[model samples]
Target: MRTLFSKCLVAPALFASTLASAEVKLPFTLDWKFEGPSAPYFLAVDNGHFADQDLSVEISAGQGSLDAIPKVATGAYPVGFADINSLVKFLDQNPGAPVTAVMMIYDKPPFAVVGRKSQGISTVADLEGSVLGAPPPDGAWAQFPVFAKENGLDMSKIKVEPVGFPTREPMLAEGKVDSVTGFSFSSYLNLVRLGVPEEDLTTLLMADYGLALYGNAIIVNTDYAEKNPEVITGFLTAVAEGVKDAAADPMAGAQAVIDRNPAGNVELEAWRLKLALQDSILTDYVMANGLGDIDVERFEKALEQIAVTYEFKGEPSVSTIFTDAYLPASELLMMK
Candidate 1:
């Protein structure tokens, strides 16, 4: 069954770009295969929002948030995507990681425990003692155990099987494992494409488990943000406009993603990203509070969860991770 971002929900998109028509340079990276959920970034570039911001943008593909975060911090790219879990860990260990968020692309974290509904999996409790799957447990997605524990799950009972990424989707469908880890944009939709009905799938995302993992937060170095607030605002303006356009028309947005997928399940996963976003993205809070809404309360809550899970001593300071000075809520004005 199609979710909110399906064909039926798409309306005519508004493409008013709130930027000057000139070339400005902004380099960026994508954390995974370019498809579906990556739409808004591509849409803004395609629709000339970046140009309207007087910016010329370049997009590159990195393996995942793990790779992108360091690159952004080191200036390999001025902007990149990383979920909240990584940010929490980085700030805990190295107070000088030098990154702050621009916007949350996905209002709900997409990391999820995916399994066959046929396996009698209804909740995290049902998967007790079950072996869920993944490739490497060393990277950003490693937060799943913390996610599991946050939900009152006994991590010792739930085993993690390191099945390589290539076989991740089929293994779950074939019942090769009890459950497997994947993003809603990547795995859940691929399952539907492989003939599993949406109703037959069970997903327990950390977001639903009270862990509130923030995915694909557009990030820039703190130093860059301090000096080039206008550039940051310009990027935010382009991104926010693209998000609105996608929410208004997903097929066109999915097409933006499909154009970038070199291989893999192109349209199938694109459709899923569309569904996933509409199910819980483009929040009223985001639109109402203005583009790139950074909820300070939510950020602190995530830090609190991280401190509990990782045993950090105390609250990390606001200066270590976030700075609102880059984005004035006043300048977040969309092109009228």
Candidate 2:
């Protein structure tokens, strides 16, 4: 009986060892640097969610929202995080690129025009005649044209200063530019850290104004996905669990990011993660319906909005841009 018990224990241990050795290495690329918003992914790695799915995920930071699309399309990376709006444009330009958004992370895009009240900018109209600092590659900047059209702002009147990502918030903080384009949570907190008073900032979220668009999503190489559907589904399932874990205890999520980014501030990252959860990730729609999926009707409206500024080379449809095929079952995605 003792010998039988030892074999039982040894069998499970050997099985676990086999599973560990069989883990598929999936290198993930993020849309931006390792910050608060990126914590959930890190949590997935740290909390063993990826390991549970037999995936060994290695995340790499990206330069901008558009950075990962091309990398994934070229098969440089199997999966990545990127702006869905940019993915639309990229598909239009490239035509038949083997890349598509698999899961919707940010229900409401954090795209916004953040300005200081002291600069005489309080509303969207104030942007007219003001020097607006914008990074050309910024996802928010890319959507600005649509926002302007929706709000009836004459683009010709607004002086757009092409600034680098690092300089965007600084120019606004130094009073060089009246306003800047960036993710609301990122720009607002960055300015606050720069000694800009919280009350002095005017954050005009594009979603609140007139823009109907989705934000950053989990993207995949279609070729890779086609060959390994189960792998993609498992990856997304792990990510959903990571998001839920982060949502349940934001500080833990923030700690995950800080672990990866030793230079990150725990409190600040926690605050940032909270803002993302409150404003973007945990929306009413996501709360009611669950995560990692999109409302087809809303997605269609977003595509129409994108059409206002970008001329599509071919007809864009829900099937081409996004698919729920790789998303886990509804039960696995629900967040409480």
Best candidate, lDDT-wise?
2
List, residue by residue over 1-336, the lDDT tens digit for candidate 2.
569889998999999899788999999999888899898899899999998898999999998766789999999999999989899889988988999999999999999999999998999999999999999877789889999999999999999999998999999999999999999999999999999999999999998888889999999999999999999999999999999888888899999898888998999999999989988999999989999899999899999999887888888978989999999999998887
Which ten residues in a row are the worst by lDDT in model 2?
Answer: 61-70
Estimate the TM-score of every prediction. 0.83, 0.92
Model 2 TM-score on a 0 to 1 scale = 0.92
What residue pairs are clashing in model 2? Answer: none
RMSD of 1: 10.9
Best-performing candidate as measured by TM-score: 2
Which residue pairs does candidate 1 place in steric collision? 19-52, 20-52, 24-54, 24-55, 24-56
By summed lDDT, the worst window of 10 consecutive residues in model 1 runs over: 12-21
Q: After superposition, how far is residue 273 of candidate 2 from its true place, in Å?
A: 1.4
lDDT of model 2, residue 292:
88
lDDT of 2: 0.92
